[model samples]
Target chain A: DTAVSQTPKYLVTQMGNDKSIKCEQNLGHDTMYWYKQDSKKFLKIMFSYNNKELIINETVPNRFSPKSPDKAHLNLHINSLELGDSAVYFCASSLRTNTGELFFGEGSRLTVL
Target chain B: SQQGEEDPQALSIQEGENATMNCSYKTSINNLQWYRQNSGRGLVHLILIRSNEREKHSGRLRVTLDTSKKSSSLLITASRAADTASYFCAPFTNAGKSTFGDGTTLTVKP
Candidate 1:
């Protein structure tokens, strides 16, 4: 079984549309994060949640929101998606917030045309 | 925003050869870690070296951290085709914030 799993492996939508990507981890991690890898391959941290509490919120647009229903699930919702929003979104989790080792799910590639 | 920056944006090597990638950060950290991302896949943690540690090894991978210089390096020995992937270094702040580098793409020719 996958330690971390994300849904909508590939998402293609028109500009101004809204979409969401779901993630879950079977590892029973206390921290989860959402990272975006742009065309230039820069992995930027968008948000982080620890035990369902928001911990890290980078300089991302307000259109991007992270919802953690529980310690094991973190979902990202994007509103009015733009072409620049197209990128590979990764979901990751760690046993503890301080641990450097993260378990990542197969990325969800989103394309806003 | 990203914290760590890796050198040699890309690297190419033949099987059985060794691949090395370097990363430099701007702030103090509790630990530095390396990760590998295969094409179209999520990144996998390769190794981590604490600020108090100089070097660490796992299988054919070796990682070294120099907290004083705020840099780290990942070395893959006896590289194989399967070893081809983008290697990234992430230095975590004492507050537990982690930022990944741009990554060094390694291509191992069969």
Candidate 2:
């Protein structure tokens, strides 16, 4: 079974479009996060939810919003996507106790043309 | 700006050779971890070394941590072609938040 899974493996949309990516984890982890990997292979944490509570919110643009209905799921919604939003989004989860280790899902590639 | 910085942004080596990647962070960390990501895939956990620990080994991969310098290194011995991937170092704080550095892309040629 895939421990962590994210939908819309590939997304190709025009500029100013709205898109959402869903992520689910079966590992029963207490913390889930959304990460953006830029073209330079630099991974940055966008948001993190610990047991459905927002814990880490980086200085991401207001166009991106993250929702966590529960500890097992986290979703990202991009509003008015722009060309700069073209990147890979990865969903990851880790046990609250072992925060150093993370289980990541197959990334969702977003292409804004 | 506080994220870890990996050295030798890209590397290419023979299948049988060893590969090493270094990471330097700006502040003290609770632990340092390494991860690998293949083309178009998510990151995979490799190893984690605590600040108090100096070195750790998992299979053919060795990791060293120097808290004094806020630096860490990952060494993969006898690398195989299948080992070609991007390696990232993440130094985590006590708050369960870790920042990843720009990864080192390693290409192991057969």
Candidate 3:
């Protein structure tokens, strides 16, 4: 019974690869977010979607896209992934209330060689 | 180039000791949050302190916010070996955005 779940816990690919990571939240949260944790453990927000509507989109590369078919799911698609694209990606969801206490999914570790 | 920046980069402490990590931010925040991440894992939310509030506690986690200084601190009391993880501080602004810092790697020895 996980609140937030992500598929493909680990992914390994060579340069110029295309991959997708799927995430789902059963907590009925309205807002969902994507974060990338770099080698130094620096986690940064890449995108945020509220009820399938784009809310916050950081300056991530255009090749990195986040698609939310519905309020319950958000999937990330990376096209032509580069070496620098290797990182642990986390999917989180939270209600748009004051608490803003997020529920995060087990991250998907992406390795690009 | 995130808004929140954590100090000490790393911390080591003995079990049963209190561990503290500090974070400074460059912009005004609506709230500050602390999360713990096991090595190569996802981060779990620990505590959150709002701009109007100064401190908050959850289990062994204590979080303090100083909006005037644009900083926050997380205090873990009676830390155990299980508490060994990378601790991150995140600050959320009015723009519906939360930025995280390069977490402080914490190692608790038994």
Candidate 4:
């Protein structure tokens, strides 16, 4: 089974459209994270959740919101996406908040035209 | 969160050659980890080295940590074309956050 899986492997939408990506980890980890990778392949952490609690929130815009209904799941919703939002979003999970190795999903590619 | 800055943003080497990448951080850290991401794929954990450890080896990979200088290096021996990927070094602080840098893109020529 895939340890960490994400839905909608690819997304293409208009600039003002809103889209959501879902992530789930079967590894039973306590912490999950959302990362955004730009065209240069720079991975930046957007949000982090530990046991369904928001533990880390970067300086991302309000248009980006993360929801964790449970420890095993974390979803990201982008509102009124802009052309700058065109990038790859990755979902990752770890055993602890800031320690250990991270298991990452295949990622969701988002293109805002 | 401590982000490790990787030196030589890109690297190219022959299949039988060795490749070395370096990472430097500003503050103290609990441990450091290396990850490899193939094109169009997610990052995969390569190895982890603790603050106290100076050197570690896993298969053909060797990692060294110098906490005094707050830097780490990853060495891959006898590289193969499959080793072509972007390598990232994440420096983890005890303060409860891990951050990665831009990463070193390694291209192992056939």
Pairwise DockQ winner, candidates 1 and 3: 1
What are the Cα lDDT values of the candidates? Answer: 0.91, 0.92, 0.88, 0.93
Task: State the weakest 10-residue window (summed lDDT) of model 2 chain B.
Answer: B93-102
Give the TM-scores of the predictions, in the order they appear.
Answer: 0.97, 0.97, 0.95, 0.97
Stretches of candidate 1 exceeding 4 Å from the true structure? none
lDDT, candidate 3, at A94:
91
Task: State in Å the error of residue B103, model 1.
Answer: 0.7
Docking class of 3: medium
Taking the tens digit of each residue's C-alpha lDDT, what string does model 3 give over A1-113?
99999989999999998999999999999989899988877788899889999888899999999999999899999999999999999999998733568888999999999
Backbone clash pairs for candidate 2 read none
DockQ of each candidate relative to the true complex: 0.78, 0.68, 0.64, 0.70
Q: Give the proportion of true interface contacts each model preserves, from 0 to 1.
A: 0.80, 0.70, 0.66, 0.60
Model 4 gets an lDDT of 0.93
lDDT of 1 at A11: 98
Q: Write the per-residue lDDT of candidate 2 for residues A49-70, one digit (tens) a residue.
A: 9999999999999999999998
Instruction: Determine which window of 10 residues in candidate 4 chain A has minimal summed lDDT.
Output: A93-102
Q: Considering only chain B, report the TM-score of each candidate against the true chain B.
A: 0.96, 0.97, 0.95, 0.98
